[model samples]
Target: MKIVLIITDYGSFNNFLSDLAIRLKEDGHEVSVITSETRVINIQDKFDYLAAGIKFFYVDFPRGFNPFAHYRSSKKIQKILDSIVPNIVHIHFTTGIFTTLFAGRVKYRTLGTFHGLGFPVLSGLKKQVFGAVEKFCFGRLDKIYVLNEVDYKAVKALGYKNVEKYETLGLGCDLSVFNPDNFSETWKASLREELDIGVNDFVFAYTGRFVNFKGYDKVIRSFLKLYSKNSKVKLLLIGGNDPIHPTGLTENETILMNNCEGIIHIGFTKDVASYLSITDVFVFPSVKEGMPVCVIEALAMGVPVITADSRGCNEIVQNDYNGYVVDVTDDNWSGVYEKMEQLIINKDYINQFKSNIQQDRNDYDRNRYVICEKSRYEQYSSIEK
Candidate 1:
């Protein structure tokens, strides 16, 4: 079977598609990825795709939800569909949702995986209006897969009968590469020394784009409060300050970055696992997410996580177990601050969280869950194309 995946950006395709392509190929299926040539992509990302035996196709999908321009992008997708004539079409993210809606019905078996719920970004009236559009899109797909439970409930609320949930492999980390066992305690100690971190210092790491909705500003405020109280705590930021992300950082983020001390910003790099190994605690205060891979990777590394109380985050972060899940809202940054402070003062709690994480690392392994995605594809392959 030939399966085609449609996604919004090259970065996501680079992060996720390799393992997926390998999984499909192992099943004797042909896999190809279709994405927009919008974001800046690395030349090595292309080689990664080539190495996985996956063919990559690029198209220009208009940024954001524009009904007018989407029509033309849909026509382009239709042309690609005509040429490839895939047995299964897997659409990802919002842009892919729009492309599927605009392209209309097709002969192939179509599946959609919702990565995030964008309704919260809209106003009351606009949200209700878009809700109808969302329903239309959900209704059209032959099968639906959602990452987080909130989206699962939202789709169920739409009363759709053909919805099944499947969590994609941690989009960024392959467990074979990210496993904590690969790095020794001495290696982590050496890395800390290399980064100028003292043995007593508490390293809090955040790995994602510098987007406003990710709530980096909130983390900054809390980190400042903690820093004032104790100088041993260090914050490491791993992603780029990309201004083009829909929820890109605001002026407040710039002010925070400029004013804050003991905060190390290491732009973006492919070596997130190495950083995760050295990090003592992973802090992610994203306001909206659909199963962030960064948090999962942190847990797999046996580093305790402190995340925002959002839909997808609930699945990975077990409060007082592996990490703490503080309430996520506009006025709850202080609540986030309080939680971080509690972790800093209590070494016993951090040790407890680490112990709990060690026992359950295998549960969140990337290799284990990619099988779920492959099985779904095989189920779709059984149906006549």
Candidate 2:
């Protein structure tokens, strides 16, 4: 079967769906990826996809709200669809869904995977508008896959009956890459020395775009408070700033991230698992997520987490078990600070979380995700026949 997967940008494709595309191609299906030409596509990313026998098609789907741009993107998608005439069309993210909606109706088996709904973070007019658009687009799809209970409930609330939750929890992590056993103590110590981190330092790490809704600012604030009290604490920030995003970090936050002494901002690197290996605690205070892959990766690395009580996060983190899930609201991050302090004071708790994580880590292996996705595609193909 010829299948086409649509997403927002090349970066997202590289991060989330590249492995799936490769696996599908290995399964003897012709798979192609369609994404907006927004970010600069890495040459190696293209080479990897081409080598995997997957095709690439680019369109301009603006990340932010712009009706004219979306219309143009939809027309471009329509042209591509006419050319490819795929047996299956699978959309991902809000941008992909909205652009496909503008392309009008098609005869292909349509499916969508909502990473997270935009309306949950919006309010007033924006919330109402996005919510209505989501319902309309959702109803048009033949099948829908959601990452978290919040999204599943939201789709069901809209009376959409074909929705199913991703059973592997989020998109699943590459266990082979993120496994703690892969990194030896010698290698970890050498990397720590290179980064000027003391062997005994309590490292708190976060890996994701430094955007507002991600709550990096909240993480920073809490870390700062902890650092003031305990000088042995260090914050490791992976990933870079997104000035184009609607919720990009403020000038003050960016400046602080750069100037802070205890916080090490290592822009963006593909080797997130390496950094996670040396981390004692992974802090993610994002206000919203569709089942954060980073959290799963951390768990796979045997690192405990301190995250917010949001939809996807709440499901992964059992309070006082693998990690602590704080109830974060607006500017109130006292709970985050308190949790950090608890981990600092009670060192035994960290070991306990790591022990619990070892037993539960296999549940997030990426192979499971690949198998589940392949089965779904085969089911659709059989139906088409």
Candidate 3:
């Protein structure tokens, strides 16, 4: 079977979907990718895909909705669809989701996975407008996969009965790469030294794109409050800022990140495992998410997480068990700070949570989830045929 996976950016394709593509290929299927130049600052060279023996195509789709951009992208998608005539079409990210919806008369078996609620962070009129758009788009897809039950219930409640299908997919992590046993005391010490981190200093790490919806400001403010009181705490920020992207950090956020003390701002890199190895706690306050891979990766590394109590995040952070999920009210930063302070002051509690996470690591293994995805694709292909 030939499968075409569509997404908004090459980075997501590279970071999240590449492994699945490889797995599909090994299962005797031809796997290709279609991506838009949307919400991504760093686009990988064609040689990168060529080296991996996967065919790649790009559609000039903008970050957000524009009538002209959508029309242009639909034409491009039609051209690709005509050429590939894939057995299955899997779409990811928001732009790709909307593009597929508006694409005229899709003949292939189409599947979409919601990374988070379509209009989760939006409010009032904006939410209503985008929510209607998403409902219309979702109705067109043959199947939809959501990361957690929260998303499943929300999507199901959208009232698309007898047409659209929904499934709650448990996302996974690469245990081989993210396992707790991957690091040693010597290696941890070396990495800490390389990053100018003290041996006894407690490190709180955040890895993801620096977007406003990611609540970077909230985390920064909380970290600042914690840092002012305790000199032993440090912040390790991973991921880069894409200025072209609508949700990318604002000018003020960039300035704050630069001026912050005891905050190690390391730009995005593929070497997340190395950073995770040296980190003590994982902190992610993303406003919206669809089963974040970073959170799963952190759990696999036996690191307890402090995250926002929103869909996707709440599913992973089993409050006071593996991690703490704070409510994102008006005073979101204070809520986060309290959780961070509690963990920082209580080493025994943190260690216990780490142990609990280690025991449950097998549940988030990448191989298992890939098998589930592969099976779903096979079923869809059979039905389509």
Which one is best on TM-score?
2
| All candidates: CA RMSD (Å) | 2.5, 2.1, 2.7
> Which structure among the candidates has the greatest lDDT?
2
Worst 10 residues of 3 by lDDT: 160-169
Q: Per-residue alpha-carbon lDDT of model 1 for 1-385, expressed as tens digits?
A: 8999888777777676656777777677888888877553331352455666787788877766677788887888878887998988988886677675676876688888777766634559868866766676786789877777777777787678787666543343576767888899899899888888899998899888776678776777788779888989999988765556643335675676667768887766777888888888898988778888889888888899888878788777898899898886765688778888888888798899999988976777666666777777788888885
**What's the TM for model 3?**
0.92
Measured by C-alpha RMSD in angstroms, how accurate is candidate 2? 2.1
Superposed by TM-score, candidate 1 places the C-alpha of residue 190 at a distance from the truth, in angstroms, of 3.0
Across residues 138-245, which tens digit of lDDT does each residue of candidate 3 receive?
877787676777666667676655333233225577788886577888988998998889989999998887665676667777787888899888899888765754
Model 3 lDDT, full chain set: 0.77
lDDT, candidates in the order shown? 0.77, 0.83, 0.77
TM-score of each: 0.91, 0.95, 0.92
Residue pairs with backbone overlap in model 2 = none
Task: For candidate 3, give the lDDT of residue 229.
Answer: 91
User: Whose lDDT is higher: candidate 2's or candidate 3's?
Assistant: 2
lDDT of 2 by residue, 1-385 (tens): 8999999888778878888898888878899888876653221352377678888898877766787888888888878887998888999987688887775765788888988886766689988988987877887788888888888887788777999998988888888889888889999999999888997898999888776677777788888778878888899988766776543446776676567778987766678899999999999988779889989999999999999988888888888999999888776889988988889889899999999999898888988988898889888977862
